[model samples]
Every structure is written in structure tokens, then in C-alpha cells.
Target: MPGTALIVIDMLNTYDHKDAEALVTSVRKALPGIRTLIGRARASDSPVIYVNDNFGQWRSHHGELLQAALAGHHRDLVEPIVPDEDSLFIVKARHSIFFETPLAYLLGQLGIERLVLCGQVTEQCVLYSALDAHIRHFEVIVPPDGLAHIDPALADAALQMMQRNMAATVCATDDITLDATPPVAEPDAAAG
Candidate 1:
């Protein structure tokens, strides 16, 4: 097992409400799996990195975003789902986590070579992240039930595309196992 990181993308309150309202039906199905994945990642001591969309708040601090989300509309749902102090949070201004973000830099810092990704808007953020990870030569694993998109058809299509074209191993949370070892030694590259 090489050092791998668990990337939970955009599991924010704003998105979850839309997903729950059936505006993004696929997310309803993906939540349970993502939740399970989070649990397993914590148990394995693998870093859990929450890659959140900043929603265009350039000066927005992660703590402020979290506080607002907790105090805002979906307080209850968002609070519990939000990553605790144990996890790391990185805010992004766009779809790709690696774009202008510390995500790539962080992964490099941790010597991560594999990624276990789970989260919202499967066809968009999830797909983009996986593709980026694949292109970066990171081993990508997307558990089938761990991600969702606004459109069910598109979500499924994206998953299939990732598995077929990007060499992402697709499995349900129940069937997948976490690789606990630290990533194998490699040249230290800047994470970003």
C-alpha cells in the first residue's frame, strides 16, 4: 500500500441542500458511501482532505466558511457532515482541485501516490479531480457509491468514463479496502 489520500470534494451544505431537494438526485445515493469512506479513512489514519469550493469568496477563510455553513440554513445537516478538526480543508475557486490550489502541493508534501476520491457533483468536480489525478500519474480509485452528480445519467456516464479511460478502479464502499501504508518514497515535488 502506497501513501494515499482521501479527497472529499464539495460536500458543502449549499450543495447538499440542492442535492437533497432532488435538484441533484444522484447525491442522495452517494452520501451514504462517502460517509462510509470518511469513516474508513479516519480509521486507517490516512489524511482526509476536504476540497471545498469557495463559491467565489476570495478572501473567505475556511473557518469562516465552516462557521457560516454551520449557522446558515442547513446547520444541522452541514455541521455533522463537515470535517472535524482531524481533517484538512482546502478551498478552491474552481472545479479542479489542483487548479490554483494547494491540493497538489499537499499531496506532494505527504508523498501521496494514490487517491481515494469521494464526494459531490460527480460529473463535474469528481470527474475533473479524478482526471487530474490520473494525468498526474496518481493511482485513482473511485468507489461507485461514493460520489454523485446533479444528473443521474451524467453521473453514471462520468463514472464509467473514469473507470474506462482513466484507469480508475471502481468499486462500492463495501467492496473496497483502504491501503494503509505511507506512500512509497519518491522525489519531493512541490505539492501544487
Candidate 2:
């Protein structure tokens, strides 16, 4: 059983969005780190879970998402981090990966207590999902270099908030270690 799972959020993109160009540049910069982390997670025998946006493809599954991304103009950005045969995938429709998704239940089912989150739009989906994971009592780790963002400033602020407010470890990909025992939550200062 894997104690920690690497959650790659919203990376199987078509590169056809309103802010695609800026995002593409960041994705290119972040690609190597993402690849390295994915490879490390696989080598550790931990679960590599790709939780992606459905892209309004209401009838499509993970296979369709992977195919569409591979066929897109930015195949360079999508190919390296594509899910493998042992990878688990879940398609989400909202900003948070847990929104209307079976991810929470799945995490419980898999006995995943800690999550290492990476991928695109650090200010949006990653931030929201970090909050959700925090509230659900799952330890969250964010590797800044492994993430892509449209705005670097917002991304930095989001990382800060995740660390300060959510108790997430805003770390580098090289610093990430999937340990079995998640850090115990601090007692509420106001309660005592």
C-alpha cells in the first residue's frame, strides 16, 4: 500500500485556452521538474494519480483526454508527463480536484494519508485542492518547480498561503519525500 500519492492536476490540457500562451511558457519551464517528480514517484512505487479537467468533453474518459492532449499543438508539453498503465486517473470539472469528484473517497479507499501535488495553475486548482486536502486532514505537499502558472506573482502568493494557512510544505521537487507518517496536526490554539 502506498502511503503517499503524487497528484498531477490539470496538466492534460489542449493549449487552446484564453491564457494559453503565458501558461505554455511556464509549462515549458516547469516540464523537466514535473517529469523528474513523476519518475521519482513511480520509482518509489507510489501511486501517480492524474486528476485532470474534463475540458467539457462530457462523453470522454481519461483515454480521450490523453489522446486529445497528444494531438494538440503543444504535444511537447503534454507527452512527457502522460499517464502510464499503472497510473490512476480521475476527470474533474471544477477548479478544485475534489469538487464533484470521487477523489476524497478514493483517497480514503487507497489509504493515502499524504499527497504530493504538482502540475499547472498554482493559483487556481492547486491552491483550492490544497485547501480541500488540508480540511480533509490529508497532508499536502507542493513542489513549486513542478508547477506551471499564468502569473508568477499569484503563484508565489498561493504557495505562501498554502504553507501558512493550510500547513502545506511549499518545497522543491528534490526535497519531496513520500513518508508513511504524515505530520501530526497542531492543536487549535483557540481551543485550549
Candidate 3:
């Protein structure tokens, strides 16, 4: 078990809208594992974060997007997994959550060691966040079933790149088990 933060990225309805109905199936596949991770995070008192794109909307907040998306019928595919009031939500203007957001600062404040990233568009926002996390030197893990992409081909490439180039430990969700013990990653060693 790692001193992990469950970082759910861009699992919003708007991004899923770009794909056909089949995307809902893909997203559905990831939800169970994500939900399990969330439960484990809560049990361990680990922070749960939702890092979402604001869709380049200059004045939009994460809650507003989540509310509007969940308010509609077509949002059935993703609404249930939306962040709750207790979860930390960061509205990002770019692909990388740490780019212009207070994600780094928040993680620092929480004393997080490893980051378990899961969410939508595995080739885009999730990939960028994983790379950024690797650069930040946070032990990054992306459970296979915890992520999805609009295009399967692109998703494969991104996963490979993250493993080979970015140094991410890409494992299947079933292979991981959460424990209450904190990770032994030398406290705050990744803050640089």
C-alpha cells in the first residue's frame, strides 16, 4: 500500500460527449475500479481529487460544470462518478492539472507521496497529468482499468509512452490492493 492520493482526471460528461455512445461502455468499464479506489482512499483517509478541464471556458468552475452535466439526461454515462462536496476538485484550463492550478500546492499541503491517477481520455488529459506527475517525481500509478480513452489506438500509445518514457507504473486495477499504511517514499521527496 502506498501513501496515495486518488486523482480522478477529466471524467466529465462534456469530454465524453465528444465520442459516440460506445464511449459510455468504455467509461463504464473504468467506473467500478475507480469507485473501489475511492472507497479505499476514504477508508485510508487519503485525499480524493477530481482534476477536470474547464473546456477553455474562462469563467467556469468545476462544480458548475459537474452540476450542469449531471442535471441533464444524456449525462447518465458519467454523472454518478462525479466528485462530491468533500472531494477536492480543481478546474484546469489546460491538459496538465498542475499547469495553472494549485494541484501541486494542495498535494504538498496534504503530504502526499504516491499518486494513483485514473479517469477519462487516457491519451490526453490523463496522459499529460501522468507525465507531469512523473516529472514532479511523485510515484505515479495508472491502473489499466482505471482509465479510458475515446480512441483505443491512441490509448495504447499513450500507455506505452508513459511506461517507457515517463516512468509510470501502469498496472491493472486488480493487481493493486489499498492499505492504511503510508507509502515509504521519503516524505515530501517529490516536492521538487
Candidate 3's residue-wise lDDT over 1-192, tens digit each? 445788888777653354746667778888888887877777767778998877667688876778766764457656567676678988888888789899998887766768888887798888999889999988888887988777888999999999998888889877765544353346575786
Task: Please provide, for model 2 over 1-192, each residue's C-alpha lDDT reduced to its tens digit, 9 standing for 90 to 100.
Answer: 238989999899999989999999999988998999899888877788999998898999999999999998799999899999999999998999899999998777767888999998999999999999999998899999999999999999999999999999888999988544333357699999
- Off-target runs (Cα >4 Å) in candidate 2 are 179-192
Q: Provide TM-scores for the models.
A: 0.86, 0.91, 0.84
Descending-TM-score candidate ranking: 2, 1, 3
| Model 1, CA-based lDDT | 0.79
> Each candidate's lDDT (Cα)?
0.79, 0.90, 0.78
lDDT of 2 at 64: 95
Residue-level error in angstroms, candidate 3, position 17: 4.2
lDDT of predicted model 2 = 0.90
- RMSD for all candidates, in order, please: 4.0, 7.1, 4.6
Query: How do the residues 72-168 of candidate 1 rate in per-residue lDDT, one tens digit apiece?
Result: 6546446546787889999988887788898888888887888998887778888988899999999999887887767778888999999999999
The collision pairs in model 3 are 3-183
